[model samples]
Target: MVFRSPYPDVELPDVPLHELLFSDLGERADRVALVDGRTGASLTYGRLAGAVDRLAAALAERGVGKGDVVGILSPNTPYYAVAFHGILRAGATATTVNALYTADEIADQLSDAGAKMLFTVSALLPTAAPGAAGAGVTDVVVLDRADGYPDLAGLLGSTGPVPEVAIDPAEDVAVLPYSSGTTGRAKGVMLTHRNLVANIVQCAPLLEIGPDTRILAVLPFFHIYGMQVLMNNGLRVGATVVTMPRFDLPEFLRVMQDHRTDRVYIAPPLAVALAKHPLVDQYDLSGVRTVFSGAAPLDVDLAAAVARRLGCRVSQGYGMTEMSPVSHAIPDGRDDIPVGTVGVIAPNVECRFVDPATGEDVGVGERGELWCRGPNVMKGYLNNPDATAATLDAEGWLRTGDVAVIDDRGLVTIVDRVKELIKYKGYQVPPAELEALLLTHPGIADAAVVGVRDEEGEEVPKAFVVGQPGGSLDAEAVMAFVAERVAPHKKVRVVEFIDAIPKSAAGKILRKDLRAREAR
Candidate 1:
């Protein structure tokens, strides 16, 4: 695993996971490590290192050890990354929980992962505390809180440096990012230290990150996209990261102007802001040299329009959570690629498209399921061998469940998802979960949820419900009911009361029929 220098033949260090942050760049101890958006707080590399060490010591004192699952439910703040890296430094696995998830949703994830300790923000403590307790969580620590939970600042200041714990980079799971794949309930994706570290190294060349690079960190760290591209890559290259707690278009543009952001890694909806939003004219965007969009497909016209307006290069990438969230990355200054293509396979990654019906490789320029074999692929689904076997083949090629076309130029265009998961603003929503929840409603006899493109051209969940015999149910009431139970992103935007839900002979919901009906 040595990267040989082409010019001077220099040998890189083969350090373990914990050593990556401490070793990589020289003279970086004095650089700014993270900038907090909420209170304009910042921590230099030296201060951040001290905090991580102390937090590691505190967790160790609490009997947290290697392979232990530590759940983190917070937004995009400085404490999020500090706690995340600290968990890894303590030789424990970090399981990221969506802060907006309902108590029952959070509880299901915590119980499934067997998380022993939870780290969350004070504002979200009400939801997470009870959820953690319900899942048998023993210890709860709140960040920036004065009471109710252990204070993060006090723990960091009081504890001493922790002794290094032995870790197997290949075998020890480092992150647990939940995804619903193509069907069923959400399952934790087991990402080992090697899986993540390899992805960092693989994406470094494409990102072209350097000490002078300044990235706008607005994406949620709980997701794999931000975890790899923004946090991990920024630290490795000694770049300045300007954080945002949430996405506000005007504030995002203001931060770019204030910080002179050189590069922005954004989702497709953000691209819409750059393309059609009127407020974009108020801010100066000359500082941004490149904009990379991922997590969902970027509309070709919108991407080009954004590039024209900002006078900067814009590109789209494609990947899944199972692939460490990055499989293909289009280089920044290249508009020569065919429209709608997500560019080529990243360095050290092998991609092959196979026919879905028959397990045979498709010819170049053909459409099929995209399969990836690389170190960036997850080790497997946590505690779900059935899913692991279905996802990863014996030869180790991970089935992406995404339909794509690979052209002669090596560029890949993702056409559709074979899986039943829906992407609402880059967050995955499993229809099966919603369907199961809908059945719990007394008035609902049966339900089938499907994704339909809204006026903005973004996927929104639309549920078709069958009322119980002689039961009175309306679309607005059903929609409102689900809205209150789930996170805002998972809410059913459109609902229709139907006499019956169309299903196959085997009892699988016919989502295609629903999508076709919406198209009409």
Candidate 2:
């Protein structure tokens, strides 16, 4: 049985992403579109539009147009917006690289995306320069001044006519974001102009972003959640975007308080800090009205704690890189939907819950793998047809690989990854559930759960925990704490104290790394 979105289907715009976002800047000409929180600098909507055109013209004059793939490897700043839209406006696909990646990792993505040009900030030159060279990308532009590279000022100084290249919104690729999918090496996810535009429109109403809104963009623009949801969606709605070069808690609070940004986007890990950190009490975060967490599951108790501490509304959503990164979100004013649930299916999207064991669809309240189809779905993984076939079906449904359950009223809650579930004595154990419960303990600062082999070689849940500062949290105590609150099979069977948990820049616990430690 296929479940349809409760919201009315929104009109997916046929115009290219650049046009859909920038064509109507006349109304917001003097309004601030981008702000540099670190420097108190900003770009008006009118100035940003002009810079985009100039840079687009320069790229076109340099023979970069439709079908070309350009790469951006800079951290979040006001100019990251300039470089990104400029690439799309010039009719080239922009593959934004993670700023935290090493030289080799950066090269891998650039090579896989077949990027023709690269852009970076000077602070990242040590990695970006080598990565671009290793990827055989000779055309490099530094968004800030670098000795032997073109700079943003130079690129935007071009007086040449803007490129008149044609873009088929449905067919022309807009961005190439790489993802590891449910399991595998990261592969390029090809998102087209239409895919991007559809998502901006589909989410605008549900996200409640408008001209009067101000978005705190601490999340890196390289990630899809930050790219589409924060940057593109904020711009399409005429909201002011305040950027932080890197996430520092004191600085994040300072920016939020100083800039008076009301809407903040974050991952689950940051939600923990907001809920418990002492430094958060030092800032005037009262200006923040809504805190939307994504990229990974946010604990229900943690969400409530944050809401209580900050006096704000807290919500979370679910998506994978393959689904243009947003398939379900908690609508801003949805009082009927639980705050921790990912809410209803997005407009124009249809979903199916399939029991992976039998490859059959399941009904409401039953746990199953989620499959979604919508205009926001990606075209496919670039140059890897087998992986694409395994993920996307002929009918256009994407096998998300994450298990989920839908309530009778259409609210959806993510269970856990299909591959990450632990099987102990024929019962399934979800690590996310145990991890969330563990986080509620005051002695536990951070925690990750993974399946590990016990004395009899049975797969059991093991927790890697980061204890709170100046606290003595024992393994046996941790196990008892969880066992007392959870099902016998779901209780953590092992515990290891660690100083920190390994995580990606996007704030997802690196389970594979934890598993690797067990293997050793």
Candidate 3:
């Protein structure tokens, strides 16, 4: 028994992503499309469209062609969006790399995605140069020109016409984002042009962002949530987006007050800051009308606190990287959804709750794995057919390893995640990846990683390590060893020395046993 969306199906376009987003920009050409919060810099819609065109022409002149993959490794900036759309305009796939990744990590993803051209900022050249070199990327364009790099300004000087290439929206992959699906190391998730456009259409009604709306984009655009929800959807609706390169609490609030930001899309961590931080009182946030939280479960109390403090509507959504990142969201202007629930299924989405043990659909109000079918779902994982087959089934249903229950009103409340991926402040911290790094330490004999809730009710990665015989390995050393290799969010915050890591007969780490020990 499948549960359908409460909203009517939305009509999706069959054109390329670049076309779908910029086709109607002529009407609002003079409006501010993007703003840099720190520098007070701005980019108008007219300039953005012209920049995209010229950049595409330049990329084509440089030999970027259809089906080629280009990499963008920058934070939220005005040029980031231009580069993103420019790559698509040139009939190429944009593989946005996480700006926080180490050189080795970045190189691994670029190599796996087969990226030929790499675009980055001057500040990240230390890692970006090495990463691009290791990946054998030939063309390197730096937005802020450094020695031995092609300047982005030079790339935009081309007066040549934009490439007029035919695109099959459904079959052509547009963006490749990496995700640790269910359980494994990170693999590239192939999102096609149709997959991205369909999600924007499906979510537009619920978002209802108009020209008057000002979106505060503090979330990193490298993540799927920000890329689709805030950037793409906000642009599709012609809303003004204020981009913050990093999330500084004081600056975030100041930007909202200064820009009169009407909409904010955030994760639970930011929600906590808004609800409890004293600096929130320092700014005039009365202009903020709606707040949409996602990436992790937002506590009911935290949601209420934020709503009460800001005197605005607060809502949460549920999604995964494989689903173009949003399958359920609280409909705009809705006041009926429970505070803790993630709200109704998104438009044009069908979902079911399947009991893993029985392999059957669960009855209403019973917790089970959430399985959804939607046009927003990714085509597959890049170059990993077995992982793709395991995630997306034969019938086109993508099994989201999240345990949830749908109420009688078609509202979904996620109770837990069946997958072992640890979400720390909305960033995915795969335990297996961390454990692999831990084992490389000579002092560590074996290790297992699990997420433990902090005092603020947020998950933090914790590691239990077994030291080598007669080796004196302290908790600090184990924590630092993993922190150096992975991103900050994936860093192990708590380390416990153990005799042996609990494993099943098949030698798989029994994380549940570790979680229970932490609970005790």
TM-score of each: 0.79, 0.99, 0.82
C-alpha root-mean-square deviation, each candidate: 10.7, 1.0, 10.0
Stretches > 4 Å off in candidate 3: 180-182, 420-520
Which stretches of candidate 2 lie above 4 Å from their native place? 180-182
Q: Which candidate do you rate higher for lDDT, 1 or 3?
A: 3
lDDT digits (tens) for residues 149-197 of candidate 2: 8899998889999998799999899999888432568889999999999
Best by TM-score: 2
Per-residue lDDT of candidate 3, residues 103-179 (tens digit): 99889999999999999999998899899989999789997779888988899999888999899999999999887
Q: How far is candidate 3 from the true structure (C-alpha RMSD, Å)?
A: 10.0
TM-score of candidate 3 against the unseen true structure: 0.82
Between candidates 2 and 3, the lDDT winner: 2
User: Global CA lDDT of candidate 1, please?
Assistant: 0.79
Q: Point out the higher-scoring one by TM-score: 2 or 3.
A: 2
| Alpha carbon deviation, residue 494, candidate 3 (Å) | 11
